[model samples]
Target chain A: DAGVTQSPTHLIKTRGQHVTLRCSPISGHKSVSWYQQVLGQGPQFIFQYYEKEERGRGNFPDRFSARQFPNYSSELNVNALLLGDSALYLCASSFYRGEGQPQHFGDGTRLSIL
Target chain B: AQSVTQPDIHITVSEGASLELRCNYSYGATPYLFWYVQSPGQGLQLLLKYFSGDTLVQGIKGFEAEFKRSQSSFNLRKPSVHWSDAAEYFCAVEDSGTYKYIFGTGTRLKVLA
Candidate 1:
């Protein structure tokens, strides 16, 4: 089976613009989560969805949002992008929510804000 | 409050040498622990995880980790290091009572040929 897949491997945007990143989870997986990895830092959780519902949200600003689809895929939307938002956006899929379930990740979408 | 810490920001090891990466966390209760490796320009791959039962867990890529509840630590180790193992390693813990993961800053390993 294919691993988690992400679209638009790379993206470029200017400040105040909007960007939408997409992710398709591994087949048969029902949980998808979003994370932001800054250069030289570990990934920071942004959002998590399970069964097409928002399960958890990180401490990101309101400008950042995400939603899960019926197919278990997910999209992360960022409005008013800032230079600080320039980072690698990663998507991870898991069999289910909770412990003992490992997450598989996609290559990630590198978003560059100019 | 909960957080993960990787004290070593960078480490250099010779190929065929033993390797160890340290990870420490601060939380009231024991939580799920994990080690992930990220190659340059790549997403993280699960190296290993410790949830329950065994204090020591073996993962893919010839990696293993030990969870010490008394030390609040879960450190990754490899019997023999390879050049391909040079990458950024992250330690994460399940956020208390949530599905979120709290990740440490990361340790970048540089393998010497």
Candidate 2:
């Protein structure tokens, strides 16, 4: 089966602009999570959606939001983009949401802010 | 606050040499631990994970990690290093019952032929 997939392999936006990143989970997966990986750093959890409901959220500001579709696909929206937002946005999926559930990650969308 | 730490930001070793990457976590209790490897411009691949039972866990690509509760460490080890092993390694920990991961800054490995 194909791995998790993400759209817009790359994106560029100016400060204060809004950006929407999309992710398609693997077939039969029911949970999706988003993470941000800045340069020289590991990924930080952003949000997780299970069964189209928000299950968990990271410490990001309100400008960062996400939703899951009925098909288990997910979209991460970041508003008021700042230079600090320039990083690779990764989307992960799992069979379910709970303990011992390992996530499968996508190549990620590289977002650059001007 | 709970966090993960990788003391070595970068490591270099000759091919065929043994390798060991350190990871430490601070949590109230023993949390689920994981090791992930990321190639340049790529997403992370799960190397291994530890939840319970035997403290030692084996994973893909000849990787293994031993969870030591006393030291709060889950260290990744490989008997021999290969050129293809050069990449960034991240240590992640999640609180019990919570699937969210707290990742370390990552340790970059450099392998010499």
Candidate 3:
């Protein structure tokens, strides 16, 4: 079974520009979460979606937003990108949004803000 | 507030030597703990987790972690290290009643020949 898949393995954008990173969860998975990993730092949770509903959100600013489609795929959108936004965006999928399931992650999209 | 801390930023150990990484968490309730490994330029992989029951949990790649609630720590250990064990290890904690998780800064393990 293929694990979570993310598109645009790498992306580059200028300040004030907007960008969208995509993710497709593993088959039969119902939960998807997004995280931002800055250089030399651990990933910070951005958003989590379960069953097409916004289940949880992190401390990220309003500029960061995400949504899950009916098919369980997810998209993370960022507006007015800043140089600090340059980081690896990771997508993780799990069977459910609970304590028992371990999230499976994608290779992630390396986003660079110029 | 929930938080996770990995005291060591980097560690180097000779191949075939024992290895241990430290993790500490701050939470009010019973915390769900997890260890994840990330290779260079790759996503994080689950090494193991502790939800309940046995405080000592075994994971893939011959890794194990002992959770100490009294000390609020979950430390990962391996009997012998290999070149393949070189990676960044992150310790995460999820609140028992919430879906959120807090990850530590991570410990970069370097295997020496």
Candidate 4:
């Protein structure tokens, strides 16, 4: 089966603009999570959605939001983009059987803010 | 909050030499630990994970990690280094009660020919 997929592979936006990033979970996966990775650092959790319901959220500001679709696909939306928001946005999908299932990641979308 | 720490920011080793990368985590409950590797411009790939059972867990690409609860460390090791192993390595811990995954800053491995 194909791995988790993300799109726009790359994006560029201006300050105060809003951007939406999309993710398609692996087939049969029920949970999707989003993470933000800055240069020279590991990924930080952003949000997690299971069965189209928000399950968890990270410490990001209210400007950041996400939603999962009925098919388990997810979209991460960031409002009021800042230069600091320029980073690699990663999407991961998991089976979410009970708990602690491993997450499979996508290559990630590189978001740049000007 | 829970967190992961990789004391080494970068490591350089000669090909064919043994390798080791250190990781430490702070959490309240029994931790679920994992090791992931990322090539440049690529996403992370799981190397291995530790939830229960044997403390020493073997993973893909001839890598293994030993989880020591007393020390709160899950250290990754390889018997012989390969140039292909040059990349960034991250240590992550799953939140026992949630889907949160806390990751370390990452240790970049530089393999010398």
Q: Give lDDT per model, in order.
A: 0.94, 0.94, 0.94, 0.94
Instruction: Provide the lDDT at A8 for model 2.
Output: 93
Once model 3 is optimally superposed onto the true structure by TM-score, how far is the C-alpha of residue B3 displaced, in angstroms?
A: 1.0
lDDT of 2 by residue, B1-113 (tens): 67999999999999999999999999887688899999998999999999899999999999999999899999999999999999999999875655888899999999999
The 10 consecutive residues of candidate 1 chain B with the worst lDDT sum are: B93-102
Evaluated at residue A35, the lDDT of candidate 4 is: 98
In order, what DockQ does each candidate have?
Answer: 0.81, 0.81, 0.75, 0.76
Clashing pairs in 2: none
**Model 1 per-residue lDDT tens digits across residues A32-62:** 9999999988899999999999999998999
Q: Could you tell me every candidate's TM-score relative to the true structure?
A: 0.98, 0.97, 0.97, 0.98
Model 2 DockQ vs. reference:
0.81
In model 3, which regions exceed 4 Å deviation? none
Clashing pairs in 4: none
User: Please, what are the lDDT tens digits per residue for candidate 4 over residues B1-113?
Assistant: 78899999999999999999999999887888999999999999999999988999999999999999999999999999999999999999998677678999999999999
Q: Residues B7-109, candidate 3: write the lDDT tens digits.
A: 9999999999999999999988788899999999999999999998999999999999999999999999999999999999999988555576689999999
Per-residue lDDT, model 1, residue B112, is: 100
TM-score of chain A of each: 0.99, 0.98, 0.98, 0.97
Cα lDDT for residue B70, candidate 4: 97
Quote the lDDT for B60 in model 1: 95
Docking verdict class for candidate 1: high
Q: In order, what is each prediction's RMSD in angstroms?
A: 0.9, 1.0, 0.9, 0.9
